[model samples]
Target: MERGRDTILLEGLRILDLTYGPSGGYAGRLFAESGAHVTKVVTGDQEISTFKDSRKRMIRTTDNQLPETIAEQLAVGHWDIVLWDSHMALHLESQLASLLEKISGSCLSVRIHFPSTVDVKEEHALQEWGGWTSLTGDPHRSPLYIGGFPATSLVGAHTAAATMFAWLEQKKGFVQVDALTVVVSALEGVYTNYLETGEVRERVGNRHHTLTPMSIFPCQNGFSFIGAPVDEQWELLERWMGRAPNPNWASVDERQQSYPALEHCIADWTQGMEREELFHTGQAFRLPFGDVQTLEDVKRCPHLNMRHFWKGQHPSDGIQLPWIIYRHSSCKLENRSHSLKRLRILDLTSMWSGPYCTRLFADHGAEVIKVEAPHRPDGIRGNSGESPAPFFNELNRNKCGITLDLRQEEERAKFLKLVATSDILIDNFSPRVMENFGLTREVLWAQQPGLIIMSLSAFGQTGPYRDYVGYGPTLESMSGLASLTGYRDGIPWLPGFSISDIGAGIHGTFALLAALYFQRRFGNGLAVDLSQYEAAIQLIGDYIIEETFSPTPLQPVGCTSIAELAIQDQRPLEVKTSDGKRSISTPWIIDNPENQTYEPAPTLGQHNPLLEDYMAKREWHHQL
Candidate 1:
């Protein structure tokens, strides 16, 4: 047997696990394979069916009545990690306090539960803590629930990572966290963009502001992506287009202005080839080329298997699954001699939130393939031009893409074939859409029972609004983001960007990774129902907590023009909560006076022959 190098990190720590279901089970599994020992503690008939070895397991008394005693006993022992996932029962707070008090040394304590503490003062602080839902949804619509079961579960995962970091650094003290602030912290790059300008970013579909030649294009077969970062690639693109490098269109800016000419050139070249051929040829040219793969195309990516990206295996259905799992170069997977190694993910989810979550996996080392349909492509795709626009490409990079007409029977079958092979399947489409396409949980499980399905929708599958047709704007309105946003005096303003959807996407990715981690340990499957509205609510949970605990509601600031002007010449406005906690937000306004309304995208398909068949055969033979 090819024993893949044991890469799982955190190898020796032991977790006194009290979590149940996929969420907590996942967290425990992650700790376990990362070189930790996760001994699940359960009472009554509820065993760790998620894993099969429960027969040789540690069991507490059947008395759910003595969980406090169980926790206290576990705390006193030499356990390095403590993971708890129980509902907020009436006496849960007292029980937890007793358990914390009994711990002899400073080990990590991970608590995953809803609010029910006696002390109300901490609630306001928690709400204002961060990942504040205020940033979610569209300006017009009520803030929607985040897609997938994001908010709380993501908070739990964040807590785990933070606690792990604290434990690793040997730091002790109360470390309060929530989903909102964690999301913001993950936006280091996005925040840098904001800091450079003086304006907050609004949604702009999938179009990127900084890069050119990064957009999805419709091909004879379907859709494909081309991302060219510089000029030489643009020239090489011209070679592909059967045209000599245009001297006039030498610069990125020049090529952007002559977008029509560039598009015409590319259109002629791409119009001649098959989708797969276009993708391979583009990749050979070293251009960031990806197919807007549908669920089907994603399933068949050989790169994923070669790279060992999908791990959670389902025997009955025999499908490889995707998870929110990634690895950094520093955390060598081959060095650790582990089952599943430490992986870093940076999810940037929105509409169905799949892309955002996959971004996390992609950023690390997971071979994430983002699926988009051309006809009813991601809503974010069509928000710009008649063509499938650059918006989709920006949100989806470092990953492969392919288009599928899920509406068609052949396409639907192709999609199923792909699902049978994917490690993770994240979709924010409504439950009805999946059902219409024959992609229900039962259907998916039947295909590959161990598949980790990260379903992102406007509302949950079982909720009253389960069938509601809501987008970022509608979800924003529903989630109360609209009411919370805008000027202090005028009507509440919706943000130009779909923060809620995007936020939900990021959080959903976190949740999916957690699930993947768990499924790996148990050899089972998990279905994460992520509601975008709920995810939004989770992001702003601290704010909601503030409203519940504080004397006044969170004050919404509409126009920051006054604040902007005040900081125009001075330092940027930094906000301090009433309790003296400080935070900052920046906008994306350009400082250069010569800024134009639209900066053009760089042309990658400049040279006609380089991207054409004549060059195609040469490139083909060269690879062989």
Candidate 2:
């Protein structure tokens, strides 16, 4: 947790943020919030309403021409980092390119040009990330864009990360974050599966196409999720409903083929139970069960309150929002605890959030062992065939693979042995799964007291919804994101991607890192109860504030994005709603940037010896 003390992180660092849209705006915000002095130089006529002023970050509307004083200041001193949004090419070309190129660290934002065979070099080019949504959403319906999780927020996160990393390296170079590519990378596995199998993953409502018993079902109260990916769990779900498991539904293929009947049966069973009660009963039995949650419910969640997850005022809005969730006493690059490369993470997550977190870790040099069960490996891995699916490969790259059935007493003990050797353990299992195997945090902590364990679930472990089953899509709806994402006077829309999953993954990573920081600085271990739904809820802080403070009522209605709303309603003095979306592509390219590619994912159980040697070395040898 970030202390509200006078001492700040990145105290004297300065950023000249000459950017726009979500990408540039967000990148600057990251630095500003981290205690850097950020000056956002924008054209006066452009909408500044979408963005608010903060303590360390401020927006200065400016003309295209550089004022003499600023030009002299630029020539005299260097900015720690210069973020140039693609929109300011002429100014960059005529005056600022040389200045930006020489900076120690710089980030360039480009709206990805999709299917580019033709050249587009016009200024203020208007284009929406339409293809992103076109390829997302339900295949049965027309293409739709999600509200709340804007493209800029996502791209800006990546850009900020890149900039920070560059600064840590103390390197003189620029990195380009393609708005299109960031979204595409998030959607990478789908494309790889398509390219390999020629099987298009049609939007199948909210149910998973490949996994068994993965869908949102309605209960007496509202919609909830019942996700049972394996046979034993499927049997548990069935037994909870007072029914016997059908032998025909033993395999994933069988269940997937019989999905319609499966869903109907689950729906019929769940429809009779109260949503909250059903969620608890299923959780008690270790079945993945989740219910739809309102924003108010999230704010009032006992687990979050107990964890002190939300507190402190946001400088942009006076209302109390979550403090910078990823806080460390210091993040100096030289500190081993702060560097991802120095830590070893044992990954028990198969699909989205946990894998995503470790992926970021591996990208920055963390040694990750992606553990799976021999009987049931990662559900995504089997989506294609004996060979791991491309989607699985893309997400789980740079990770060593091993198999362990924690359900077995011997395997559980072996897992504990490995835990002693690891710095952190990450998993996104339904809360009860780990406990059912007797691998609870207390047990693991006994074996390794300093371990930082992150239990990532759809809901936090202690919450009423802890055992609930919901993925990225369902989370979008339950978290009020879906309600806020549609066109004005239209139905709520899915962003077509699992943003919550990705967000949880990123959030999980930062939380784990923060825990590591805590361990080093304060000699304490951390049990992080990370909820995907909670992470999604946190992203809509501004709306939560509006709902809390404004005298005017704000409901989750189908409307354009808050970026659009913040512009029209709050900053109406700047951008026109009629202007719609603009082309955000940049014509510039990285001339000579350094790059590194990762090693391939290991074969499942390829590193079984690591477990065999865990007790001896208290460390696993890496495969070169």
Candidate 3:
């Protein structure tokens, strides 16, 4: 476990560990191993627990009362980075402010939280942000929550990287992050998909919108994912089966109509072989064929093991954490030793921006410690009435978690002690939120001269809409993504997909890396103000530009022009009789084409528990 800490990534940094719950914890876990000194500060009662034999210990603090004195003490010391959940600032703004005034300078502070719809008053903070909930969902229907803690957790990583940038620049000032910005970053690819084709992707029930032979196929026991993106792979598949393309399934459209027959044919051939054989066969043909592995399968994949994607470590007692890697690099020997190497992070800015940003850091190669309040947990945790579900786990992979009642005078002291040695800090609360929490940039700079800080929110901290509330769906609607999808013949619809939130994470990683590069070169600090809603809007840049330049502006899918095109081009040309039933007939002829289809979305909470147990056992026993 100790050996892993010496990883060539973040070798010479100190991280003040103070992230409560799974989201922040996941971030801290990543930074800790890359040679960062992450001192997890917890209330004394919260003993460190390690489900496996990992070395990192969860420091349990004796003080659970509000107003963290530990945080103040840590801030007064020599630290580089600071991480915290949003509630820490909201609940302990006063106490933290006083401490911040007293601290030296140079330390970065990070805070993460969920957006709130309700207004916040002293001792009465309400959430329900605008972007996340409104932007990505159908306007007519009630907004539905997308399940994925990564959306929020990666915000933590953003906070971390942005803080590091400021530290390297020796900058001093409060910073804020926008959740919508993070969403936009992650959705760039999807947005590009639309721009390249002038087609907004609809909820096609997991079917590919344009690509053929790229869908989930049913197997004997479960499902397997397959992708034959090119014609060569398709030809290889046919050769493997020793059969030519059927006449009815020649073209893409024809294959859609004759889907049943194609499905049967493919299943007959695949069902006869073993799962390994099928996987190997696909690999042999240079096709992408992956099993729908359970969490357990993820733990045991040989490729992952060879690549060292998951770290086997016993942090304390009962928890077995398999550190997952989302970022990687092949070269790190001469370029900066550590100080965050092989660690790529994307911090999607939002109310809970810091958490989402840092989660990715933890996954790759960075010790990200998130600071949060025990009295007030992250809003997203309580939103669905399930605090730490798979949603949290998925986002917080490979990080450490802890609590800091920043309001307490004593806990503030502990926070300083931890921060004296960190790499970055991020926050998504409003501009005043940090001031209220006693985390002004001056205070952090006094503590650590080279600390980077990133502030994320709905709008930037300095913007007019900085205080807006935003969640996934709301952000979709606000970012104009929701207005782009739907049946071409009907009204524009909100995509059920949470592309905004996910895209932000990817974008955050890119931004964080750029900031990190500046830090390493200058040895100074910086403060980055990230806007989540603006970030979401960035994903649709081409659309915005085209609208400004084109004579006829593009509207949503169901606009008049699109509706006309659909009627003329896509209406079923004729009806057909199959057996005794009448069915729609495809216009084009098909000789033998792949029947690319997808199964239903996996049921919520359908992860395999037995496999989880086995993986847990492996984590407990040894480094496999």
Clashes of each: 101, 12, 219
Better of 1 and 3 by TM-score: 3
> Tens digit of lDDT per residue, candidate 2, span 264-362?
888888888887786667667766555555556555556555544554433233222122222232322232344556677899997776787787676
Give the whole-model CA lDDT for all candidates, comma-separated.
0.45, 0.57, 0.43
Q: Model 3, 479-589: lDDT tens per residue? A: 544444433332233343445555454445445554465456445544555556545544433233333222211222221121222234322222212122221111111
Worst 10 residues of 1 by lDDT: 596-605
The candidate, 2 or 3, that scores higher on lDDT is 2
| TM-scores for the candidates | 0.44, 0.73, 0.46
Error of 2 at 273 (Å): 4.9
- Model 2 scores a C-alpha lDDT of 0.57
Worst 10 residues of 3 by lDDT: 119-128
Q: Say which prediction, candidate 1 or candidate 2, comes out ahead on lDDT.
A: 2
**CA deviation > 4 Å runs, candidate 1:** 1-8, 18-26, 40-78, 84-91, 104-106, 111-160, 171-175, 192-197, 243-250, 253-272, 308-624
The residue-level lDDT of candidate 2 at 40 comes to: 64
Ranking by TM-score: 2, 3, 1
TM-score of 3: 0.46
Q: Pick the TM-score winner.
A: 2
